[model samples]
Target: MTIRESKRLWMACGVGLLWFLLLLWPMLGIKPDGLEFATTFKVFGYVAVAAVFIMFFYQVKEAGYLDSVGKPVKGAAGALAAAYEKAPTWLLLGIVMAGAIVYPLVTERYAHDVAISVLIYVCLGLGLNVVVGLAGLLDLGYIAFYGVGAYTYAILSINYGLSFWLCLPIAAFIAAIAGCIIGYPTLRMRGDYLAIVTLGFGEIVRLVLNNWMSLTNGPNGILSIPRPELFGYEFRSLSSMYYVILGLAVVTILAVYRLNYSRVGRAWEAIREDETAAELMGVNTFLLKLLAYAMGATFAGFAGAFFAARMKFVGPESFTFLESAMVLAMVILGGMGSIPGVILGVLALVALPEVFREFELYRMLVFGGAMTLMMLIRPAGIWPAKRVGRRSEEAE
Candidate 1:
């Protein structure tokens, strides 16, 4: 073998061995309460086998054997893409809408619940997409806006006796105001500095919610938040709530999709590509950035209100840096600036974990590994935005 191949083989072996040794503690050494290992060596054996497979795969990859095997897979993917591109837009939309509408009726309760979770993230993802994807603004505290919406609904419902529908707009407007407040101060910043400022803002929001006992009830959280009512009928059942959220998600998707193609969206895209250039071309950079932040916050606020009503509770714990990270991950994984890609990301990141609940503890491991692999293999994302002629404008 060549020196390069030899080095790659050694690297692969080292990585596989390192992975197995590092995971040994959590996988085998520490057992959860009331859990049985059944066989002392079962987990270890699996890890060992997995390590061997990884080493073998790496060796094959280094030797360039995977190129031959992957040709068919690539060909199939190309064929699927071509077919999808050739299909009529209305047909695809109809198929998707029909499936979504009938999903709750056909699926089991657990699946429906998971679907609701996916939809919530979809809404959040689309909202963030406007700022991060379109405007090139990094927001690490997007969840703070979400929290704002939930708290708005909770405070209004309990104190003022406002209905869910009435509180929805209020929550959105309040969250937008919060977004503008954050944006106004930080619009001059970019990249890492912007991220740090947003992160601090998110922490500040959470701290206020946690410490303000008179308003948020501190860590105990506000309970018994009322469910949404439709035409005087309270949506108490899981199925009923699922439908309500489905309708909301649909509206959100439509609104975002429309906005993505509007004049505002073009301006946002221009700013994302080059703020200086966009500003030179007569674009109001400051105002558009604030508008982007507010618009994204608006959808997140909508989702937050739905989340509060659905759970019948609002807690400071629910809005955190980790939650913000997950939403950002969804936007990145799916493909920034791509609406359908964001939805796909939400489904995978949200539903896959619930599907594999038995291995819940290893979720972070999987997510980290998946993200690493994605960055290395497909940095542009699963369904990256393409700049094709007039067709691109129409398709998007």
Candidate 2:
């Protein structure tokens, strides 16, 4: 690296470290009885030392001092990619399915719970992927559909004593209707305006759930929701529930995969790239956008129905804006428009918090920091989707 660039790098690192120290001290050093610096400095020292080491190694790598080690690593990565491309699709899918089938048998109940959560989010992520990733619709209130589905199942199961299997499609249908309702008014909006309308819609749903005493029980939440039953057996165990969600997730994956390569998927992509051009080319931007919302919300409804069945409850708090953001984050972080990427993102975000549960108060702190680092290091995502063609500058 050039001397000027080296100096600038170190300067930026120094400033960042100072800023981190300032933020860290106020949080850790301020106590109830008195202010203290010992604990704060101790933690800061560890962070500062680690940062310095990382920067030093980075600088060395940039200077080509690690070329001998880097070259082999890069070659190995390329070979692995080539091998992956050559592998049969069924073989890869079989391996994944086998692992999933065995997961509950190998892990404890808590692990099963986390896995269930991951699978549920996977469904949500893929559903949202349809609108945000493919159609370029920025939906901030997608969780409202989720809530709709959950409440649909909850109400049906409790009031009418409907079976979980029967309520599933019913929930999906209701959520799809909700999606169209929300998507209709936002048809003319785009970017920030669309986001604001969706956000409002989501909050409105939450408020209704919170205040609708007759239907939602005013946040007391519905209870005694029956578990899903197949034939004569009820899914009352965690392992059984895991399998249920696993099947649902697989269905979601298949449906989304088909849509991704279909004519509708191409239309969504065209609309995403340039809505005006898509319209000029005879694409029905209006109906397709509404379809995107409905399709996306359908999977969410499936997930929500399952969620209500598993939890035996549905409440306004569960469908908060934060939940919507997290689902969106999973999509963006994993690689929008990629099914596998969404699943990986779901696993990372859902499992990481469980893994760091021992950290107690610092759990979210570590999670936020990791997300920021991931964004900075790979802004496109962990595994970005492959587009049809490259831009002119990129091709050049």
Candidate 3:
């Protein structure tokens, strides 16, 4: 073998060993009350064997075997896309909608819960897609608006005895107002600075929710939020709730898909591509951006209210910065500007972890590895937005 290849092999081995050592102590060594040296050594032996297999896999992957396997997958994906483009749009939509409507019937309660969670993230991802994917706005404080909606519902339900139907629009409106408040100040900012500002805003909101005991009940959280009801029939069953979220998810998908083809969506895309050029061309860049923020926040608000109603609780802990990051990751991984891609990303990220719950501790590690591999193999995302061939004068 060449020296370069030899070095790479050793490097892979070193990485596997390091991972084994670092993960071993936490995975098997630490006990609730004390160290478990015997268990640690036993697990270490298993990990060592696994490491060898991992090293071999990495070496073979480096040798391009994975690429050869991936070639057919890529070709299949291209063929699928071609087929989708040629299919009747209404037929495709009908098929998808029908499947979504029946998903709760096919899955068990646990899987239904996971599906509900996935749909929630799908909604969140689609919302953030408007701000980040369409308008190119980096919003790390998006979860703050989500919190706004959740808390709005939680507070209203707990104090005023308002129904879910009543609180839904109110929560959304509050969140949209919060979005406008944040968007106005950051209208001229972009890139890393904008990200930092949003991050700080998110932390600030979390802190407020944590410390404001008088209004929010602080870290204890607000609980006993009512679920949605129709004609006085409460949605008490898991399947019913699943169907509720499923319906909402469908509405969100349709709305976002429509927006993507609308004039407003085109304006956002123009802003994403070149803010200065769009402004020079007479696009109301400020107003359009605010609208994007409001619209995205509006969806997040809806999801948040649904989450509150579904879980019947709202806490500062639920609206962490990591939640925002995960939503953003879903948007980016799915293909930043592609709706179907975002849905797939949410399904993969949310459902796959649950599917492998036997290896709970290793799930994050595996997920991170999978994401890294995806980035290396498909940097543009699994379903990147198609670039428009030519912009019409009206579109510009």
Candidate 4:
């Protein structure tokens, strides 16, 4: 509110605008014919105006100018939170389940497809949450397990004429084995080194799938993977497939929720908070770490099998590092270690792209900007997990 602070704020904003313009010009203004400034300047002008407006609003709010307007809104939010806290757990779950059950019936085919994708990511996100969120392990190659499950189901269904239901567990088991293989050597590593090793393992899986023609068909991908069946009925319709994935997601949710409060979950948390201390407490860090990876990969394997069934195809391209990163982002964005947070994250990231599909070229630009803004504003996540115990830093 002071003149000096106002000047500093404006100066920072101006510098940021100029830097943004510099970056935007190269991307939007450059052409084979010649450099152009009109389009770039137009976009820059809109952004600058929005930025200025936001900055001014922030200053006004900070100066308490908006207190009158904000009070009622804040009070309403507080009341809502209080009511939510008082609500029964089963009632809340029933509402959510009802909505999910009705989603496919109300939406069109495209929406069904998107919903299916969202559910798939939900499973993937929760699985990753076990390792990265609960166990405090960084896994950049998580999609490799996804690929393993998909290809496992794909090959089994195609080669031996196995049923989708039968191959699901087989795929999950194989993915678990793969997880243990990846987790073993990295037991001693931590932080960035562990991240690098996991990244390598993910790429190694992709490369094997890409080059191993005899097994994976070398990028041609396995095709005609049968849809899941119950009795003699096949899930040939999108709506039916949606239900199938919904079931898997529900199962994943239950399994993860149980694990989160289990003794194993507590041990993983202990290991995450301090591995050395956990070992001193006789926590068997080695086997538990392997179990974390196995459990995480098992869910991903289920998802992969479902994915293969849904798409009727499996390819190396689908299991790329970028996919892994996006799933990880979903976990971080929603709130690490929180089941609901992971689901919300999956919905946001998956739905936003489709929602912005009309924007065509600038969709990613907008998406990236939104993500950056979110990280800056809510770095802890949209819905961070609640910790059971206070940390040293929080002690007063």
Which candidate tops lDDT?
4
What are the models' TM-scores?
Answer: 0.89, 0.98, 0.85, 0.97
Tens-digit per-residue lDDT, 11-90, candidate 3: 87778677767777787677889877787677667767877787778777767879978899999999999998999999
lDDT of predicted model 2: 0.93
Worst 10 residues of 1 by lDDT: 34-43
lDDT of model 2 at position 41: 91
Residue-level lDDT tens digits of model 1 in 1-396:
587877787787778666755565556555666434444356657766876787678767767889987899999999999999999999999998899888878888888788888888988999999999888999999999999999999999998989999999999999999999988998889889999999999999999999999999999999999999878899887888888888888988899889888999889988998999999999999999999999999999999999999999999999999999999998988889989889888987898888788987667677777888897898877777664245455768
Model 4: per-residue Cα lDDT over 90-145, one tens digit each? 99999999999998878899999999999999999999999999999999999999
lDDT of 2 by residue, 27-112 (tens): 89999999999988998898899999999999999999999999999999999999999999999999999999999999999999
- Per-candidate RMSD, Å: 4.0, 1.2, 4.2, 1.2
Judged by lDDT relative to the true structure, which candidate is superior, 2 or 4?
Answer: 4
Clashing residue pairs found in predicted model 4: none
